[model samples]
Target: MVTVLTSGLASSLMDRLRRAAMKLALGEQPPEDLPMIAALALADGLESPALVELAGLSRRDPPADIRDLFTEALAELGLPMPRVEEAWIDRMLDAARAMLSGSLSPYEASDEIYWCLCHLDRTDRVTEPMLLFAGLWSNWEDWPDGRPTIEQNMREAAADLLRSHGEQVSEHE
Candidate 1:
């Protein structure tokens, strides 16, 4: 029981720490609007035009993982996964690079990526898990050539370092 209690306390502390870090990084009282916007975009499968309108209303970025999250979520909902173009992959990679660096936070990254998807050309939008997946891919220790983007490499390195210390990534709620 003592061990369980200690573990619970540690987990709770970690949660608090993560929240504090995110809030500090955002530099503003983070609004709940971003997550809600994400949820709305995910739920409605809002087209690019609609998404642009949605972005205008958001104080934060749109759902970053809409493509992947939607794919998974829609699968569960017994709906077909929407087929966004593949060129979005490159855009996602670029966005991921920006995100990994201090140039952008995950929230900002997710927001802009979603914004581009909603407003930018068909190929210009960064679609996900591919966006997210590539960021993961470029981080491999075994990759002979360095990652095409410094930001992605940094993100991968940071994630790896954190994992080594037993830090785990959680889904955004």
Candidate 2:
């Protein structure tokens, strides 16, 4: 299992990603929505447009492996793919598969995924949503009685990020 210092921002983004991934996996949402949802989750980070573009590219040419898709997405966004150890990738893949198969809850899976992403970010020095979200999530936890407003702040930040990137972001509820 991967570990991360959870904060409100990280929790919110993880929730958003997990929900989007689940919805996509369950066929509740169209493939095109993935990037938009990712953009919303990532806010104004470098990964947002890349995710959106990745979804578009996936529609044109789907990759066989999800990891490949993720790599390609980052590359499409002009970001370098982090060099993660094969062992870590294998472990994450196993965990992710378990999550998709319903052996793990979305929350658990997202947390692990966040850690994996963080590991990659730390190793590569790249700016990714998972890394940023993890930091924010950790910082938020230090604040006194900050939970209630954190979610809203996260959304607003995401919206601001999207708008700054010239992408139209809509708040979900």
User: What do the candidate models score in CA lDDT, each in turn?
Assistant: 0.40, 0.46
What are the clashing pairs of model 1?
61-111
The sequence of per-residue lDDT tens digits that candidate 1 reaches over residues 1-173 is 01122545444433332332233233322433433443454344332333334334444444443323323333343333322332333344445546655577644555445543543353322243335533544443345465445444445543443343355633220
TM-score of each: 0.21, 0.28
Candidate topping TM-score: 2
lDDT of 2 by residue, 1-173 (tens): 11232466445445555444444433444654455555553453334444555544443354333335544554443334433343344334444444445576434544554565554435433245465545555555666477446534444443443454465655552
Candidate 2 Cα misplacement greater than 4 A, ranges: 1-6, 44-173
User: Best candidate per lDDT, number?
Assistant: 2
- RMSD versus native structure for model 2: 15.9
